[model samples]
Target: MTTSKAFIQPLDRVAIALMLLISLLIGLIIWQGDAVKPRVRTFTWENQQIGSEDVSFTLTFSRPMDTKSVEDNLKIEPPLAGKISWAGRRMVYTLLTPAPYGTNYKVQLQGAKDKFASQESSNRLVQPFTGAFRTRDRAIIYIGVNPEEKGRLILYNLTQEQKKVLTPKDLVVMDFEPFPNGEKILFSARTTNDQDLLSAQLYTVTTGIASQADQEPESPGRVDLVLDNKTYQNLKFDLSPDGETIVIQRGNKSNPGDFGLWVMPTSTESGEKPTAKPLKSQPGGDFMITPDSKAVAVAQGAGAAILPIEGDATKPLDFLPQFGLVQAFSKDGSQAAMVKFNTDYTRDLFLVTNQGTQKPLLKTTGSILNCQFDPSSPTLYCLLTQLVSKEQYIEQPYVVAIDLKTAQQKPLLVLPIAQRNVHMNLSPDGLGLLFDQVVAQEVNAPLSGNTLKTDDGEAIATSDLWLMPLLPIADTTTADIKPEKLPLNGFDPYWLP
Candidate 1:
């Protein structure tokens, strides 16, 4: 009995020792794995709001990396349109062009080693890292509805089929411009107070939620104040394509004649910067922002002047005195559209080059209401109106597309005279034109916060927005085209860049 007990006790002790030794070995392995591996300090928004224009990306690591190990091991799934650079423990990838929207991207690093680890095992990977990010869906924003949704900005994601109301309660938003980066919106808003329309002030709202190392998880859409010109009245404002600058039109509190274009940064990043400073431009007139944001075409006096946003604003470009309004500028900033008004109220549309040379494109007894340039082609979409009935002075308005190179003009849509508060827009892809036709039986009173002409200078009966395909026309004539109806009621519809 004594011999049996001793043998059993020793065997049990041996088994316990083996178990303890196995546990100790496992702990050592885990500790070594953590100690030798490098870490990444991810930028919360690194891949969240990637747009086609986001050319640069930055990645930071906890330790200095072996340049060759990372450069050779890093792989972007499906490939991307960009180049890469290294900086100590950081990596930067600059895109040659914008990444296509609505895509999922995966980044994998199979054989990456830190500098210290390279000394021990030159080809060994410290750890395998994998991350996935997605490009934003195609989205559109428009002001819609009344009573409950009045004066609010609505964001509709086309890919996700989602809708989000961006603005908070009760501030009547008049006019808003989205930044090129799609990260913010520069808007003019006025209180419920029935002040003069000129009293509208510019404010910036954060439409994006950037990832931060220190911030709590929060939803985007934060409204922030930009500039409130208490003395001068602010009007039309345009945000530059790069999202760096803003050009605004302001009028004096008492003298409407004392009006000019102003320039300021479109950022509230440091809080409301400065009330925009007046540019060297002529008195108030209809104007358009050049793509470069360096110049603007102001329809002043009897001519259209291409005035620099900075520098000698007084010394305007000596354009043809007969050209009255500058309509549209090409996306590449190479060409422009200018109008020449005749003594008999006849309107002539001319295509102007960047070198200030002008060529007449269309001549008609009609007025050019609005125009937009096609981003991908040499086409100009212009709204034309002519007095058809001399007795009633009834005018008919139509949308026409003109091929600048061919000097061919094709009528796209014949709008009804009852269509009021109409504006034309070309989709970003250049595949479609989006516009809205509003008609009212009774006189349509202009919405207080509305900036663009809300009241139909004449009367329009039923208001609905539409989308028309821009391509697939075998006939250069208007009959070959058919517009699809979009089930929405909005005046100004703009596609995101």
Candidate 2:
């Protein structure tokens, strides 16, 4: 037994040789100083499609890197302007602005050297890295106005020049808001047999776009009913920025006075249907979900109250008494554009901030139809009407860019006068503005499934979608910019996030 234990097999000799080789390599590495090329240990956004919410990408190296060398040698195709920062072996590239939609981008770093690379004898350099990323395609969703596709939600891929009808012709889509991912749209529609405008029900329809690059895109026009209008009439609705919560204004059918804002999760547990829970707060008007998605800003009484959608709804998180309406909030949620109804029958738009700053932005004699904050810049784009004639009370709708920092207002375009149904949506990249110029139908027919109406609820004969490219506020004037009319005929056109 002792002789058998002393015998070493050929396999054991091979293992011992491998161990000696590895030890020798390790000893050489330590004795001669590390000569191995630095490599990227991790990359946060490799081969990913990012959106507005993605502000930065990170790179972690196997060893500490020269910050200035890495920043100077790094290159991004399509030339994204960004600021580089470092923390030991990690590097972060913060985008100066959201990358434009419908574009593919590449990042390269071949010449960047690690901090300890200079002392090595062999070619002291970092391993060449080539990473790729992309932004979501440029797309828009609108209610189709064509004879064959009337009253249906249509998703038009501007980048691919592809169009898909998202809702069927049997139901007339009243209003819709795209999910943050653009994979689905939340909309309200009424059945073909039901003509009452207030009888619309909430539904979700697939957009034929996959939420992830690896997932296969499903066919569009698959509709799922979310909430029925049998007990309550669902009015205006808003989807939170995170796409996790939905706030809808509802009014009880039996009790005319029973009305308030309702909150619900966009998803539910497995085998559980989504349900809406009434928010225990005062009745609100023109409600919207805050940027955080945890609270709802509702126009209650004479103030805009920020009420938690979840626990303790009765206690408001905040209240701004000066603002009668919240037009829009900045993506950062630090500021908001609010409206105040003046005693002299005027509307004043103010820039209200979370830092207890209420700065006046604009004053209008007519209505402040809508306003959106530019996600990339210190600007607020608004669609408003001006009282051109007192006798006729003629109001002309126009688009204007207001610089939040300098308080400079630039009139972009003056739309057709008295087009109250006109709607405007700012592009996610802050490079374009979309607005619909609608032609109202003279016939006052009863509401039907085939009948189309503007977002204002007025019957419309035809509508044209227009896209206007925006310039930096300081670079040029409105005279140089032009509004390009799209080939689609639809109202309430909105950019798919």
Candidate 3:
């Protein structure tokens, strides 16, 4: 009986301790009483790299709150053009246009207040919260003029407003495309030895370097020969947006049988060797690598072929066998500008989509130089030459913008008939067009049998660069939307990727 009483006495003390614990918990609960301000769980995208597709930012908070206070207090230093919205505790800021690459941006929240209120005051986030981020490297690279600078790849930084030559001075860059990351430039260059233009090989030069210390060592990555084949000449090549594949149009110097589309892995198991296999198709003509990079729209004879780079390479989707050229594809690969050649060799331009038939835009008796689909809209910009006289083959060239919705074409600029190498380049924002024109005296340039030539013999001329706004704005009227000549004397101007 004595032992039983002893055990019961300890049990009673244990019960008393349990009761005290519960009372303390209740007191703490009463003290809290649901009085809390929205707390920042995290301010993300801190000093990280973003791309064009990454046009949105997310901010998470500890609790849901009023969207108005946050929107009013939010300020992006340097001011990014964007829109703001709210979702529960997340503050989403979406950019109307992608932030230009190679820049630092800061976002700040001042005097942010939550929806909840206490008896005495409104619950507010007291501290000024800030987040910092960076965009991918960006630049417009072009070939330079002057014999010394000619063929040199020029990297003009859009963000830094600086320029750097990326290629060796001895190499003359014919054409180039930048990888999506803006890190390296893949170019076709030939040795300045008066060598056959077909001797040009594919090479990559570093146009970008990691500005952040945490990134891969600030390496001006090596300029490596990506593909070198003495047997075949690499002409035009495109790197897939996903950076997994490189589709090159190569012409065998000796055998016409070797002329076709070649698919190669952009990366290798061993950096020492590059492996490229030919796609099972007819000889290549003009083609655009799809944004998805899995397939390419190739110009096969008078038709367009969509051939796959992987899986069953044997099968291809053929479209419009009468169309001689596939000028361009839309950003989403949903639409294309196709050109058909008549028996007279005159070209007719048509707009076709992935799910639709060819909608005729314009037909020209001269030639269709090049055409590109605007990234943000259904408009297609084209450079076409109109035959002024078929007898002498005299031509007048113009830059025209065609609206796919209305099927109306507007001539934006009319260039001199002699501007033979005219190329139209749209700005990254899709608001401006850059092109080149030649101003020269018509000397006794005897008519060249192949190309457009003057009745006189001397074909001496000077090339001038020009820029024109492609958009409607408050500052410029449509009548006043003339091409402004740039001081830069260059051609084949391409917007950096």
Off by over 4 Å in 1: 1-136, 209-218, 268-272, 355-357, 444-462, 472-481
lDDT against the true structure, per candidate, is: 0.70, 0.87, 0.72
lDDT of 2 by residue, 345-414 (tens): 8999999998989899989999999999998889999999999988999999988999999899999998
- In terms of lDDT, model 1 sits at 0.70
After superposition, the stretches of candidate 2 with alpha carbons farther than 4 Å from their true spots are: 1-23, 120-123, 443-449
| Candidate number with the higher TM-score (1 or 3) | 3
Candidate closest to the true structure, highest TM-score: 2
Task: State which candidate has the highest lDDT.
Answer: 2
Q: lDDT per residue, candidate 1, 144-244, as tens digits?
A: 55445555676666677777777775666777878775666778877655445556777777655332223343465788777787778887887777777
User: Which candidate, 1 or 2, would have the higher lDDT against the true structure?
Assistant: 2
Which residue pairs come into collision in candidate 2? none
* Local error of candidate 2 at residue 15 (angstroms): 8.3
What TM-score does each of the candidates earn?
Answer: 0.69, 0.94, 0.81
Candidate 3 clash pair list: 443-456, 444-456, 444-457, 445-456, 445-457, 446-456
